[model samples]
Target: MRLAALQEDEYALLESDCLFHLRLFEAAAMPVVEPVLQRCLVHSQRFKILNTEPDSRVLLETANRHVAIVDAVKSGDAAALETALSHHISTIVDFGPDVLPLNAKS
Candidate 1:
């Protein structure tokens, strides 16, 4: 994942990103929710790659976030893990292209 990010290969980076999340769902052993996550991931893939190639800084930060998640998990730091997860989620939401702000007038 870090390698993909440093290389600036968005497709590979995206693959790693998806794999990381999917693995989380798999590890959780949530049979029903896993499929729902899959569908959501498909949209995630579209929103990511279908937009302009992401900035390299975003890719690097993403890689760092993944590492932080793993570190928290390995250390059994639930609070840290939640923080990392929240950061990752917020980063994705904020950086997403074609995603309109809720307060924007229609």
Candidate 2:
């Protein structure tokens, strides 16, 4: 359809990707952050080219934190998971609201 519609669909898909990764962490043993982390890595490059070097570094650190979180989850280390999650949220906040998609309620 329209470009806006396409972007909406893309945003929804990415949100679903995060949700699926959370579900996997909740119900299974596998760490499903790979897909989301890979996307964030690409976003870092995009942010850098867009002259948002700070946000790009934040995104890269967030991706690295995801790897650590995944390892903590796989090892069943709840304390590590909590700390990692906190750092991850802080990194995203530093990345700022404009860098992320704001999907409207459907």
Candidate 3:
């Protein structure tokens, strides 16, 4: 399924990114990282939808941040990785609620 469609599937959306990270980590011979990252991603998705629809800027930012974080990890830059992760988490904490509209009940 396409990203837009997958983004709508609550169960699949975060899982998709987690799986991607898993593959990347595995290729880097760091498969052990997947479980922790996957767990965090899964838990975070429940409250913060990374692909919260219709916001191209949010999506772009998320993608860019992901790339930066991955690069930091790949390069074994502990300080850069920490900084990248801090910024990513701050963005999510600050903007996550703005992206998710209130659900209407019948």
Candidate 4:
């Protein structure tokens, strides 16, 4: 997706990581964002290298997951979001303040 498609607030939310973007997107009433967030959650589960600089494999895996989820959401398959959430709640919660704040925000 082009950076131009997202508002500054949306971009900031995205840059904040999986949980932040997920909660913000849900609060903003854009269900389409759920799948993308799910993909991020999944990617976070598969990789653990982020704490030690960057790795191309990790980045690529994450990006690929994001693209797949985005495509699924665009096609209106909301079930994918639930599937992702169920499978990766730990990763989602690990995003710390991002996911935690979602409870209060809601």
Candidate 5:
């Protein structure tokens, strides 16, 4: 996605999800979510802080990437957004059982 193709509504919806995921889990999706995140840290200068502690950096980076994804979504690039979303879903499915909370009422 070029970021210009996404409709306003689509961008808004994806942006919301990205923000929510960042708030809840620190990362929107794994592996696929990494690049977007790295870009943000590099752009935001948080990457330097991350280098001081790899483990902590990873956690923070994940959250940063979620924000980046939202930015990308807002960019309105349909292809990029679609790719990001696809990877996000894949990451969720892969880690779903471990990370997802079971229904307490069950």
Candidate 6:
């Protein structure tokens, strides 16, 4: 992702980002969620691309976010892992409904 970001390759960065998360989703041992997640990630890909600005630091920011996840997973603590996952996801949710048109509140 970082390499793709540095190279300014949007497609590669998005692909790498999605693949990274897909592996984590697969790790959860839920077969049903894999396809669902793939669809969501792919569906959101275009919006993400559209929303990006040339100056945005997507990869660096994403990599920094992943550090907490990696550290938590490495610690082998379930509670810590859960917290890490929650916090990581919260970053996405923090954008609020405005950022995701489909999620907009009535």
Number of clashing pairs per prediction, in order = 0, 0, 0, 0, 6, 0
Task: List where candidate 6 sits over 4 angstroms from the true fold.
Answer: 94-106
Tens digit per residue, CA lDDT, model 2, 54-93: 3434444433445766787799998998887777657653
Per-model TM against the reference: 0.76, 0.37, 0.48, 0.38, 0.33, 0.73
Q: Rate the local accuracy (lDDT) of all candidates.
A: 0.83, 0.53, 0.61, 0.49, 0.48, 0.74
**RMSD to native for every prediction?**
4.2, 13.4, 9.7, 11.6, 14.9, 4.8
Deviation from native of the Cα of residue 70 in model 5, angstroms: 1.5
> Between prediction 2 and prediction 5, which has the larger TM-score?
2
lDDT of 5 by residue, 1-106 (tens): 1231132233343344444645433544477776676555344344333343334333343444455457666897878877776665565322235554677535
List runs of model 1 lying over 4 Å from the truth.
Answer: 95-106
Q: In model 2, which runs have C-alpha deviations exceeding 4 angstroms?
A: 1-21, 24-62, 95-106
Worst 10 residues of 3 by lDDT: 1-10
In terms of lDDT, which candidate is stronger, 1 or 2? Answer: 1
lDDT tens per residue, model 1, 1-106: 7888888888898798899999988987999899998999889878767765577887787678788889988999999988988887777755547667778848
Which stretch of 10 consecutive residues in model 2 shows the poorest summed lDDT? 1-10
Backbone clash pairs for candidate 1 read none
**How big is the positional error of residue 75 in model 1, measured in Å on the Cα after superposition?**
0.5
50-83 per-residue lDDT for model 4 (tens digits): 4423444444444444544455456767698656
lDDT of candidate 4?
0.49
State the displacement of the C-alpha of residue 42, model 4, in Å, after optimal TM-score superposition: 18
> Rank by TM-score, descending?
1, 6, 3, 4, 2, 5
lDDT of 5 at 93: 25
Q: After superposition, how far is residue 67 of candidate 3 from its true place, in Å?
A: 1.3
